[model samples]
Target: MAKATRWRNFTRSEAFSGYVLVSPTAIYAVLLLAAPLATIVAFSFFKDGYLTVIREFTLQNYVDTWSDPVFRAILLRSLFVSGMVTLTTVLIAFPIAYYISFNVSRSMKSRWLFLITIPFWTSYLIRVFLWKVILGYNGVINSTLDIVGLIDQPLNMLNNVQAIVVTLAHAYAPFAILPIFVALEKIDRALLEAGQDLGESRLMTFWRVTLPLAMPGVVAAVLIVFIPTIGDYVTPQLIGGGKVPMVANLIQARMLDLDNKPMGSAIAVSAMAIVTLVSLLFLFLNRRFLRVQK
Candidate 1:
């Protein structure tokens, strides 16, 4: 009777209720995410064989992965492309978000948000292909230029890093905009009025107050864009025309085309490690900034 009463009391407690609520999600994450990640990590350490993983543990995959100059170049290119995409996306997103957050009335914000999300309703693949058509030789831009007598022949615009960046920035614009809009919306109106009342210029007030508070959203947008774009296979493969292979392309070639699963896994693991380190570094800096602000 006493034990039953104690158990009932424990179950009714706030902490127990919280754990119970979270248990399903925790279990789901362990099964879906943790299990697959562990398998990949295991595969990275094993030897590669024809159509099968060799039973022997070996570091040859890592050695080969690190020793190759091509892999290094691809890795650097992936990082550069992702960084550019993140920067461009954030820079473009901030103004649109600011307009919606500050200039638009509260009653119309939902409609504007819906408009912002309209692009997401379409297929991502279709968007990429559309950009390909736009940038291709003899395509819309080139034909327009030719008709306008701006050039004697079509300009070669497709299948390059710039094209890839442009496509990715367009694709990820919504992701960057939404978070920043949320951050901006959360800012107290009184704070702005306070700055103005203190005799600060509008630009000075924004520089000193608004941007600092919005750093969290900016960081979130950066991570959201950078991490996935770095490992993207489709944009670089299609838009880049295989001339500029990112890390994901290399991993795909290794695992599928080259029949080297272990090496691919090693490369994948290494990429995950780098991404984790970068994420942690960003989080640390964000925390430090918050502490200093406080």
Candidate 2:
């Protein structure tokens, strides 16, 4: 009777429903995400032949991937561009998120969030193309500047690293903002009030109490912006004008243009490894701040 009662409780507990609820997503991840990731990792160890992947296991693909100067340059450039975009997006986003959380009335907060997400109403590819148009020679900015006599000729804005950064920062702004807003909203108002009561200035209280509490959202914002921007293909292709190729472009070139799947897989693995290490390092460095809000 006791065993039967325990079994009945177990069936209705959150642990059971949690499993039931998560099973579909877990299965989907295993089939769609893990399987392809395993395939890529497996291919990274194989050898590339003339229009064929050699089944023989070897470390030569990784060795050659690391040895290539072009790959190193492109990978470094990708990291730099992604880092700039993350910084630009987060720094700009924090203020907007704070304003919405602390200043906007509860009634108006939804409208503000709605406005923030207006950029998402359009397709991402269309947005990238729009950025291309904005920064292109004889495009909106150049045309307006010329009309106002700002320069002698149209500037070469497109096909550069800066253009890539600007396009990505704008694209990922909403992502950064939402996470940060969620974080800022979770902060207790009493904590800020207590800090001020304890003789801390508003700025100092925010520095000590507010920012630390919001660190998780900030970290989430950083990782969300950083990871995808590093692997971005469309922005580099459109905004960089195919001249400033990042890691994604190189991977595409290897996988498709050169028909070297192993080499492409190797590059992809290396990039994933680097991103993982950077993300771990960031988490480690921010462990203190993460513990604060708790």
Candidate 3:
């Protein structure tokens, strides 16, 4: 009884210390993320236009946003592009992650993982621009095709939807791969042995054991890749040829170009709501799958 009481006292003190340590980060998030988000919410409901001080509450901005065809189109395009990029990244990253996790020596695994990190040391804009140069009409792809006599004229590679997906996929591939690799590495060798002992073939063992165990990584990869790529405006602007605009671009144009702050805030809030809903759905599915496996 005395020991149990002492252990409880020790746990209470440790919990207090841990909270003390995390308190600064919690405060920082409030100062940065919470404050700005609250301000955006407040501004989203403001009555008048940019200059008008109509402090009265109104849903006019949201109504206008929903009615705008351009905003709706932009939102759909963002979802499509982000979905494509996320799927492609996962497909490409999966095999690489599997090989590294299951086949490579520990020493080589560390080296290759380090190589992935090397790309992050450079400017993101510079890396993206490199893709632009490679995919441009007069760029390496065109030059190669021309030299091979594949076509008479340069292909219009710039300012297109394909270019946006390709560039974003390339940019975000590491994010997908790392999570998958970590998950794959966490898998137990005993599970494979158990499957084999149960007369499962190699493919069956992988399907029944490996894939199920690594699903958390898969979900993580998808969420990480999908969420940001869908909201990205820069890649769309650079490679989407000004012809295709994602929701982010629309928000940017409304906020800065058109000087319509209320509409922009409304759009921002709506996007946040959509993202939150999607994320919750993903989490629910992940948990359901996890429970089934168990």
Which is the leading candidate under TM-score? 2
TM-score of 1: 0.93
> Residue 2's C-alpha lDDT in candidate 3?
100
Model 3 — TM-score against the truth?
Answer: 0.92
- Can you rank all candidates by lDDT, best first? 2, 1, 3
**TM-scores vs. true structure, each candidate:** 0.93, 0.94, 0.92
lDDT score for candidate 2 against the true structure:
0.95
Tell me the spans in candidate 2 whose CA falls farther than 4 Å from its real position. 1-14, 288-294
Candidate 3 lDDT over 1-294, as tens digits, reads 999999778768978789879999999999999999998888889865555535779999999988988878878778888888988999999999999998999889999898877878888788888988999889999999999999899999988888999999999999999999999999998989988998999998988789888998999999999888878878888887678888888889878888877778899998878877877898898888778876
Cα lDDT, model 2, residue 106: 100
CA lDDT of every candidate: 0.91, 0.95, 0.88
Q: Ten-residue segment with the worst summed lDDT in candidate 2?
A: 285-294
lDDT of 2 by residue, 1-294 (tens): 999999999999999999999999999999999999999999999999999999999999999999999999999999999999999999999999999999999999999999999999999999999988999887999999999998989999999999999999999999999999999999999999999999999999998899998998999999999999999999998888799999999999999999999999999999999999999999988995556644
Between prediction 1 and prediction 2, the one with superior TM-score is: 2
